[model samples]
Target: MALTYLRHQLHLHRHKIIGFFLLALLSSGQQTLAQGKLKGENLPGYEHKRLRWGFSLGVNASWYQLEHSELYVEAIKSNPDFSVNEKTGIGFNVNFISSYRLSPDFVLRAQPGVGYHSRAIEYKGMPADDDNGIAGGDVTQEMNTFAGELPLLVKYESKRRKNSQMYFIAGVKPSLVVGGQKKGSEYLQVKSLDFAVEYGVGLDMFYPFFKFAPEIRYSRGISNIHKPSPGMFNNSIQQLNTNTITLYLNFE
Candidate 1:
């Protein structure tokens, strides 16, 4: 049932979720036909430069990859921990990029960013019917986090195809999280720092003045964020880590 509900939710947001692929496909088709009569290469001299700077704005969906402990499964079988669920949430980011060209096909980049995110975890169990728990239903704890992120990335670009090029990037992103309910909540404890590895692909479209890149990335955390909870439902969680997918547009 939960999987079905998640599929339905993804279906509702299909455009947002799959827009990057559609754009990439459309641009690939444009590359073959649009460059036949162009005067010179796209961004004629931009790639020759050594230092470049840019800014980006993006939208993201953030969630957790939860790993259940044996205790949690046992607790469920014992009927004290009925079900545990997670719901991903939308997020936004603003970033500044500093780039150093390493070669025609490779570049080193550092992008520092700030992001806002909200994610929820639902824990359903036999309620004690007390103030520590929700009165009427399953306990849903929503956490809003402000993240400071620093990513060191390397970009590998394909040869120019008309006014567009495709690139792949891989990097490490370290984040410091703040302003979450973890500080005072009776349930749902999370650590403040997270580290993740990221990989992505993008299409770079060159205009007369600047370059625009539409990118999609998938990132997974290497560090566990879950902390043991003193309350009933939170105790059932053994491992929780970050999972996120982001779509970005960069102005460079």
Candidate 2:
């Protein structure tokens, strides 16, 4: 059920998401073309540096990848229309970046950051006498959290063209829930630790003083973050994984 729902959601929005990324990529290319042609190579030696530091600010949209439990059938029998859904939410992140140059085309990067997020789990068709007893028909519970994220990544870059370059990044990110309700009687509990795979593409625009990059990244949770708790909403779900899409503005 989780996989099916995820596929359906992706199918519905894949075109819009793809187009948005392509448009952004095209706009960046155009801007680079307009300026790079008139400017001599800027920061010619910047890429050769053994180590560099920078930071990133980003905005994100986050949701959950949900899976039904074995008790889902029991839930359905109790409430014929019972279903669980997730709502996407907006979030933001700030990262202090440190990178090491491995070769002309490859770099190793570590981004340690804090992220703030608020997402929700929605339950529909709950019986009136449901567990946690709040005259339940449809219940939406919000999960707000602050996470400390550490991402170790490998960046592969294209050959520099004048003052612009394109790159792809892939890595692993491990996160700890620094602030949030870990467990409760009224809300679905979530585990404090999570691990995810990260991948993204970006354009690096070189200026006289700094390198500016616009990046679009996606993170897919590999660990099930669900923690059992005392609620029908929690009991109906067996797995909860995270999904996040972020657009980052980077400076180095």
Candidate 3:
């Protein structure tokens, strides 16, 4: 009787062990199925990551002027036409963007980059005909300036479902006068700190691996670049200021 009791006990233990394994298998299978369903549901929402480093190349019609220069006004007369002819030129900019998605509607980005700009001013007549002309000079004057610039911009991206986005940006750009010539001779020696306040609007287009941003910005110089002079008619010259408009291409 004791042997029969032992046999029944062994059989009960075996049945319990089998039941536990069956329950474990069912639970594991259910979990796997649930995971598969969740993956399928989320597959469509997953987007590929964008690149962090990119290059930009485009053309810029840049304008450059002297800031609060009495010389310029004396050169142009009381009319004080401060507008420099738009120089049709080209520039290249490269960007390294750190993009973070704050929410579905907002993406914050920081971009720091450098660029090249060229500008020129052509005059219609020789200064010798007027009192402002260099003594005994009869040649028309043309000025060409080349600058190197670095810009930092913080842009606010708009919320939209389309491939394009509109942004407003405020930034600072410091430029160095690399080269300048008037009448084929050195004209103006600029300062080391050429600082400007930059504000602009931009458009960005999204692609699979990269984004293209084209921007138009206006910059106003804070410092007076004009050399002070003593003359009753120098007020118009002293009022001359420097500003610029830039077209830029950004990629990231």
Candidate 4:
């Protein structure tokens, strides 16, 4: 039952991601078309400077990778029919950007910020969706990871067209969890440190005063955040992977 709900939500969010990409595409296409008629630059002499600073605000959806153990399969055989499902959590992103111009086509950037990340994996055997603790309707165990994130990225931009340009970025992000909470009765102990490689694309629009970049990116976790524990709940999951998709609005 939880798996079905999660699939529906995934379908919905997939469309949202597509919507962002389409908007960026349309906006870029118009700007590119306008360049054929207009000769002047959109924001004259915007990237000539050697150094720039800005900040970014964004929203993200977080996911998890759940692998069932042998014990999990055996336990399911012994107990009543049950299955595990994962849900993506809605979160926010805030970053301070410091960038350096390596050339007309390349820039080095560091985006350091705090992110609110959350995910819930439910054991489907509950009565009510409310926090009665995984007993019968759709009871989920929620885990929160409040961490400080530092991402070092290299951004590559295409040639400017009517002050609008497209760019791609790739980097490594390392984080340390500052705090976290188990919101319900169930507790899952996750590690405090995480590291991942990040990559994405963005559309850069030049305004008279500032540059705005609407970007989307994905980050995958290489860490297995689970520890050895002697319970059906903890023993069920063999590996846990982190996944995040974020859409950022950056102003410089």
Candidate 5:
């Protein structure tokens, strides 16, 4: 009788342990199911919402123009005998961007960008004429500048189901002149700093799975960037107008 009682007690204990383990397994499964449902609720409905970080590299065909100033003509005519060539050139830029969704249709973006620029002038004409040339004699001038820029823009996505979007951007970019020089012997110094009010329109085409976005932008600078040479008797004016078009690849 005692042996039978002991065997019965052992069997009861084993059954209890097995029951506890089964209960724990069921509870764990329930928890996992509940967590999965919560995760599904937090998933984004729009395709673009999945894009939050990206990088962009592109080229900018830039036009650098001097503002209209009476002093400009005066300076060219100081010697009154040389011709001046003013022309815009091409440039390149790279960018890193971070995007944050403000709404289903709107996003805020911050982009830090860098670029290289070049412009040139060739002087020609009669050296003896006072009404047509410069005091520096016949000369050619070429300037190459490197600039760093940062832009913060609010972007509006198109409501269409296509992968294309249109955006209007307004921002401020301050650029520093890192390198430049005149071709001839005339001593010239470019201004070290330029501030611009930037406004532009851009279009972006997103690839499948949000892997990359290729975009094109057109922007205009609203400030002048010229500093007159010192000790001049006239009110020397400065010109600082820039027009830039950029093509970028945004990777998210």
Candidate 6:
């Protein structure tokens, strides 16, 4: 009898329960839509400024792209163990940004900055030496550099979606070595000037006071930066190009 009574109660309240759930779902969806619309309205017309200024802090991982000389290739035929290995190095940078709005979807930017970088190349199966840390018949050459960077880029932006917009940037950067190489011990040498092409993608977040962006960029050098020296390790490399990946946090 209690089961029959329970069944009758469920049948009578089923339509009311369904209505309650439907109302709750509709209310939740409407609230979500309203919040999204509100978010989309943030920083309206922020991109219409003729000029803007900002700054960025970044961390970078850098490595060398190397081409072996013909002499080195011939040497490798006789000694297969003769090899050079590039090790990735990490560094930091800071940039002051200047931007000009060309259109709603496009902007021009220039960033001038300074960075400190370290990179290493390992020579395997080298002659054992007591003086230069090659006691085990291998030597690692580490280069630490401080450089000034100037980059000019074009940025293309997507339509804003809820408080954030996506963008793509492509540019060229020219750098000059400011410091960080000590004179003496001559295993490897690098030129003072380097130029690279850079490309990246970022998301611009709108805030009440300012804008913020987090970006990831790739850089590739078009010219060889290696300077030839009178050393086996230096002569073995025909070309050395720069390759770096950087993650940046920007504020405007």
Among these predictions, the greatest lDDT belongs to: 2
Report the lDDT tens digits of candidate 1 across residue range 26-110. 6754763475356455678786579999999987777777887676677677675477787677777899999999998899999
Between 2 and 5, whose TM-score is larger? 2
- Tens-place lDDT per residue, model 5, 41-127, is 222354456357777776555555654357547666665554444544455677788888877777788888787765444445524
The true-versus-predicted C-alpha distance at residue 188 of model 4, in Å, is 1.8
lDDT of 6 by residue, 1-252 (tens): 332244335552323433443454345445544656776466778877889999999877677889988877887788788888776666778999999999889999999999877777889986444554334357778777889999899999998776677789999999998997655335678888999999988777777788877777788999899887655667688899998777777888
Where does candidate 4 clash, by residue pair?
Answer: 125-135, 125-136, 126-135, 126-136, 126-137, 127-136, 127-137
TM-score of each model, in listed order: 0.84, 0.89, 0.54, 0.81, 0.63, 0.80
lDDT of 3 by residue, 64-139 (tens): 4533344545566743433323222333344455665555544455555554443333333323323333332222
- In model 5, pairs of residues that clash are 67-239, 79-134, 80-130, 80-132, 80-133, 81-132, 81-133, 82-133, 83-124, 225-240
lDDT of each: 0.76, 0.84, 0.47, 0.75, 0.55, 0.77
Runs of candidate 6 with Cα error greater than 4 angstroms are: 1-40, 128-136
Q: All candidates: CA RMSD in angstroms?
A: 4.3, 5.1, 28.2, 4.9, 26.3, 17.8
Model 2 lDDT-worst window of ten: 1-10
Candidate order by decreasing lDDT: 2, 6, 1, 4, 5, 3
Q: Which 10 successive residues of model 3 have the least lDDT summed?
A: 181-190
User: Which residue pairs show backbone clashes in model 6?
Assistant: none
lDDT of 4 by residue, 75-127 (tens): 67865566776776767789999999999899999999999886778777522
Q: For model 1, how big is the CA root-mean-square deviation? A: 4.3
User: Pairs clashing in candidate 1?
Assistant: none
The TM-score of predicted model 6 comes to: 0.80
Better candidate by TM-score, 2 or 4: 2
Give the lDDT of residue 237 in candidate 3: 33
Q: What alpha-carbon RMSD in Å does predicted model 2 have with respect to the real structure? A: 5.1
